[model samples]
Target: MAILIDENSKVVVQGITGREGQFHALRNRDYGTKIVAGTRPGKGGEQVESIPIFNTVQEAIDETGANVALTFVPPAFAKDAVLEAAYADCQLIVCITEGIPAKDEAEMYNLIKNNTKSKLLGPNCPGLISPGKSNVGIMPHEITLPGNVGVVSRSGTLTYQAVHELTQLNIGQSTCIGIGGDPVPGMSFIDILKEYQEDEETNAIVMIGEIGGTAEEEAAEYIKNNITKPVVSYIAGVTAPPGKKMGHAGAIVSGNKGTAKAKMEALEEAGVLVVSNPTKIGKAVKEVI
Candidate 1:
């Protein structure tokens, strides 16, 4: 059982006319996701192979019942693309574009978070996948093996590495989600954690976070109180200097807050097994499970 998506999800690519959009949407569709329709204003009435393209998301949804939306537009248009999908009521809206303004990210988050229409995944994310069930975004499907472990990560690179390592160790995952490293990402660690906690097929959890925000610390607190599942965690940017932004826009450290050490301490206090080395993520999950 996957947390958010599975064989039942029907997807619509918002920027399907673009190169990246066409590539991933087709890749995902070929991988078994039901890519029912696509949306690109002037390219309406066209086709990305067999899938139909509509002028608007609502048209796509109304025509094909596409419940999931993935956006692969440029940074400047990301906010509008996402808001359009949200208004069209895509059950799950995934924004794969990076470099969106923080204010724009916040606006989308606030509006969507307040609405019951959509559950937004990311604005700079790799999207998510339920191996053998469905694949969305750019994460390769070959590295995954279907099983029970549920993975949630802030870093897309770490998410892939963790999944690959787990598969190498013969540990299959039920679902793997890269929630993106943007400062104002639509979803948080706690959101995915809650879903994992409620998912009956999920027996253990692997949470990967990085330096930047108190999200990891907040998730630690949530795990302390609400989740009873065994958890393994890895926080990146351990040696990063204060006031310097790392690879991610949100990966910044100020004073004592948002440091890797601080996040590690918080998770440890909540009884989570914290691994200092990123390479040990698979081993950590193996032990916990």
Candidate 2:
């Protein structure tokens, strides 16, 4: 039982007419996603990649019964796209668009909680995928393998790196979720941790996190008290100078909180195996097993 999405899921691409949107839609379709419709305002009654297009999410859902939405809407209108999907009753909304304002995400989160019961994966996320099942975002499916270990990360590329390394060790993953590299994301480490903890197929977990967020600490606390699965973590931005930001826009540390050291301490204290080097992630997981 993979979390969020699998092979049977149906998806609608919001802003499917755009170049990026079309590109990913084609890629997702080729990857075996059940892409039934697309949403692009004023471009209704057309088709992209053979999937029907509509002016709004409501129309797309009404006509095609799409339960999942993968958003490629630009940063400025990304909030509206999410709200539209929520209104259309999409069970899961995966926002692949980046740079959405924090305030807008707060509003979108509120809307999801208040008006709709839909689970939002990200406002600035890579969405999600279950290898050999379904993929909705930008992850290349060829590198993934299906197995017992579950993975979740804040960085997209790091997620792949962890999965690739695990594969080299002949350790396939049940699922790999990239929750996004944003200051505020819809799905936190806690959220994914809870899902992974309950998922029967996931016997162990690997969390790939980076600097500049208290999310890892929060997940550490949860793992210490709640989760029973073997957990391994890798914290990026270790070599980053104090009070200095890293490459990713969300990679910034100021006070005592949100440092790689602080997160590592919390994770270590919580009984999570912490890796000191990025390249040693697979070896560390190997040690845990």
lDDT of each: 0.91, 0.88
Off by over 4 Å in 1: none
Error of 1 at 143 (Å): 0.6
TM-score, cand. 2 vs. native: 0.96
Per residue, candidate 2 scores C-alpha lDDT tens digits across 99-183 of 8888898888887888888888887777778988888898878888988889999988888888888888888888899998876
Model 1 is weakest, by summed lDDT over 10 consecutive residues, at 108-117
Residue pairs with backbone atoms closer than 3 Å in model 1 (clashes): none
Counted clashes in each candidate structure: 0, 0
The digit string of per-residue lDDT tens for model 1 on 1-289 reads 7889999999999899899999998898889889999999898999998999999999999999989999998999889889999988888998899899999999889988786579999878999999999887889999999999999999888899989988998998889999999989888899999999999988889999999889999999999999999999999889888888787888879878899999999999999999988779789888988
Clashes of 1: 0
Superposing all C-alpha atoms, what RMSD in Å does each candidate have to the true structure? 1.0, 1.3
